[model samples]
Target: MLLKSPWKPRLADTEATVAERLVQALADDIAAGTLETGDRLPAHRELAWALEIGIGTVTKAYAILERRGLVRGVKGRGTFVAAYQARQGTLIDLSINAPPPILSHRALARSLMAISRKVDADYFTLYASPAGHLEHRRLLARWLETLGLVADPARLVLTGGAQQALALAFDLVCGRDGVILTERLTYPGAITLCRHTGLRMRGVAIDDEGMVPSSLAEALDSEGTSRRRAVYVTPTLHNPTTATMTLARREAIADICRLHDVPIIEDGVYGSGTEGTPIAMLAPERCLHVSSLSKTISPGLRVGVLLVTPAMECLATTALQALPFSPSPLSCCVIEDWLANGTIRSVRLELKREAARRSELAKALLADRTLVSHPDAYQAWLPMPREEADMFASSAASLGIAVTPPSAVMVAPEESDSGVRLCLGGASFDDLTRALSLLSGIGRSTRPL
Candidate 1:
């Protein structure tokens, strides 16, 4: 039988470093269970010849792995699995929203190498200024131009992640005892932020198109005495529900914000997936667009970019002043190189393909269920029979399949829905396929209460 190879190596240069080859070999050993917890790895010379690399390279690779806590080299013996296995339990974690499948690490490694060659290594070691690195800002501005939003690099703030940006936006727009508006069922992060900041949040009703314009208007009117300052929304491929607002709805909402003098905090984290004009494009002067590389690029690179209007630049700056620095420069450089080269496009294409495949899998598995989802959505919203949501979640979890029940995402404590969200983009194609199959079996079975 052929041994399984978990390391997806890239064939770029023929003279690949010994470190690179050993990394692949080590990864393969870990995947094949040859290198279990406390299993001793071969010495530098042995691993070097096994991977066709120099002894020094093997040492360097082992050092890197050790730094990552994947191995530990003993003085007398040799490198071992550190008495700690990193690949424990299910690799498929469906709780968080991650980027599309990273099929190969070759492109990422190549990008890192390119950055090391071209950019100053020391630049990545330091903290970025408030406005971020000039080159990074320039590249981000150019990319934003593609989306039809002309960004003044000075007005842009590089955040640790989109969640930080959201927190900053809340700090700037909402005051203590002030109200912030969001959809009935929205991203949990936003809700949690409001709770943390002591700011009150009003859940606006949403339909198939998104937050109802009339509902927003009504909320604003009800809060007539208090300041109705900001509105948060995910207009494209929205989280959980996967609803994209129509152009007409976008215009109406923009008009409302303009009339009420409310700043619209548009969460465009998933904006890159769809091929439509952004709400920022509709009203750049009134919209503060927040996006991150986590959705499209690697999540480990915790970098988020914000585009604020000239009017709101002072507010944006003030909020960013609290954080006072940019994210990891090494991560930014990696992402910049990927975006500069054609790697990002290729990655996106692969992601889209993988998303399509997963969608097909979901359709086939949940053929008899009622689910609200997009073809490329990371999660699916399924409305089951009353009181069945909790049971379904429990049953799925019992089978080692994690799911987000309605209670987990409910806006109000008393207003729980009779449904659950089954995430499809959490694991590899095969793992997701098996999980979905098991979930489908559960969805189809009728249990007596």
Candidate 2:
């Protein structure tokens, strides 16, 4: 009897598109002498029907193989195995959120030298305060003011990175068996942190503006005020999906949270090049704003700043002290110098232009696809059927380019996202263009009705 076909894939581990997986399995079968060079594969719809998958998926897979010299199609006769050629090159990464490195080396060098000359060397020898140095905190307070908040030095807590800052914020406020409410889809880090801490998280419904106020109230009311610790949000240039909550939405959210005595954990990591009034500004007593210089500056620097009110300062600092490491002294020195001399300000302006250019490139290429993004945001979202998008993303990965599948960032795994996040800022312009070109070709591929 003929060996059973290996085209049926366990997708949880497979990185090739379902169609590509079939091509690959067939190729392997031919090499192993299970199928000869002259053997004919199953007809497209017949094979798709057998696999219980879409014929469009099968068509896309076959098209790719035909172009790569792995298969040949005849008008009346079904497709047959052909010679396959190996592809080469490093994988072009588009899966990560890291922006293209654009820091001025000269500026960094000058800042380092200035720190050594102007600042006392003794400061470096001592451990920084658990929260942060007073002067450094003061400078950070001034920086926050530009964002529309009148920050107090005591209210600011510095951490290694925004991830750490967020962890601390959650740890400080959340007790055991607590539930943290958040937007249905949110930053991946928050989901991981909640799982690690054994804290339950319930996703609230959201519209284009952001978390629906009614949904927020209903979730809070159901959970009761006692076990609900906080409501986390990415108010500006929200990750994966660029949903910036309007000022009115922010106020409405604040009102509901305040009524339930629920604190807000606002993430602004992607806010460097964008402008939006923060939730913290509207309800300082109820919000903790978290941000970093990673996307705007160099990720290598690893400086994150947290803004809280004086009433919450002690708890925030206690959480800060609980960590094995406080803020890095060197990173602090760099941040302090950059903030004081207006270097960071100038860099942000330049980076803002770069982000806009990258975003435009994405819009131009994927205009036909369902896209969700901001002009100044570093990533864009494309809505596709969940299985189709997953298969497409895997094929993109197999072709040596990486794109983030929606499930990676989904807060509720069972709730379907059915899309991918195309990170525009991670690669250089040329690299981004090429990857996007390949991606667009996939979109432009003809689909079976």
Candidate 3:
């Protein structure tokens, strides 16, 4: 019988260097246990031949793996697998962008236990309407009062998450092969969703205040009045580039969208540190607003609400049904309790304070360096020399800290700002401080790429 091949790499072809790709291949295999603990990787010359790449690239790949402590160079004995990964290292995760859980597990458990006793068993077991329970939506409207919007429960829909809300909004606004207008740098979730929907995007340039209205007006005019174009925006604490638009800027964008009769999708997920009313409030007739508790409470709740135009309300309901919407009764019950007992407002207050503190910490840490962020934002954007961007990010990842790459937030390749989005949430205050210190140092180094 033929022997099993020695460490064949099924690497995905991409723009990443051959050596970087090779390291990723080995790392993935090691993670999957396909490459056993003691099983040696193929020799550099052999791997190069197998991969049909230069032998030098394989050498670099092995060196990178050794640096990450995933393997070892055994001198004359040849490089051998050392360990799957180093356990001693403290991986300060600044990658994931989510609100840190401010509530203790014990407190949350007590709340859930109390809720179960109060709620009917059948109510919790049965599926809710696609738009969720009537009372839950009324509470969602009342909750919006704090944010300066007086939404009607009749025009609202409950979604599993902001992503679901956004999906339905995209589906309602755009058709097959539709085009959406967005800021040059926007949310990655929307970017990922558009890829699946065949939704083409036209990017508008932004200034310190936010997406330039002139840029948006020009793009809309170029697309013509009859074109099915929808504009998506994160007005306050705009993702990856914490550039909050002024109220005037919001109105300017509203006028342009209204003039062209284009629908506006307002992503209000990060409503925590935002100011003024949502853009939906500015142009209620043509806007679909999405808000979620994921960034405020816990993602486990998976609760989201949409403020859609009354005429377009059924679109969301229909889209939710098509997606087989089933809102989590357990989570809705938790929201009910939290909203009733003032727990939601208290948590929001605490998270707001925490967010401000973290933002200040980041600013202070990188005071000498360049960082674009709002005082209340959860992340800061760092722009880098285009040529140095690749090495800078690769180096940081190699050192065990994570950040949002520019490619993730950019819509067009030409709009790719060579930088990273540094999220301030997720990690503890201490871990954040340490990570920021290392990041500041790494960022200061102007070494050749």
Alpha-carbon deviation at 384 in model 2, angstroms:
2.4
Clashes of 2: 0
Task: Encode model 2's per-residue lDDT on 97-132: one tens digit a residue.
Answer: 876667767877888999887785655777778887
- For every candidate in turn, the CA RMSD to the true structure comes to 16.5, 6.1, 4.7
Residue range 150-269, candidate 3, lDDT tens digits: 799988888888888888788888876678899888888888898878888888888887789899989988887565789998888888787887899989989988888899999888
The segments of candidate 3 whose C-alpha lies over 4 angstroms from its true place after superposition are 1-87, 225-227, 414-416, 446-449
Off by over 4 Å in 2: 1-87, 444-449
The alpha-carbon lDDT assigned to residue 357 of candidate 1 equals 77
Write down the lDDT of every candidate, Cα atoms only: 0.70, 0.74, 0.77
TM-score winner between candidates 1 and 3: 3
Inter-residue clash pairs, candidate 1: none
Q: How displaced is residue 51 in candidate 3, in Å?
A: 6.1
- Write candidate 1's Cα lDDT for 1-449 as tens digits: 22332233221121123454455456445544566667776666655565566778767776656654557877766667654323236644455677666746786677777887888766667656676887788877776665556678887888788898777777767766678887877886887788778888888888887889999988887788556468899888777687888889989999998888788999988776345667777888878888887776667768888888888777666655676647777777776777777776777677767766777778788898877877666777786642466456544544456676554555663554546766677587778877787777777543323
Clashes of each: 0, 0, 0
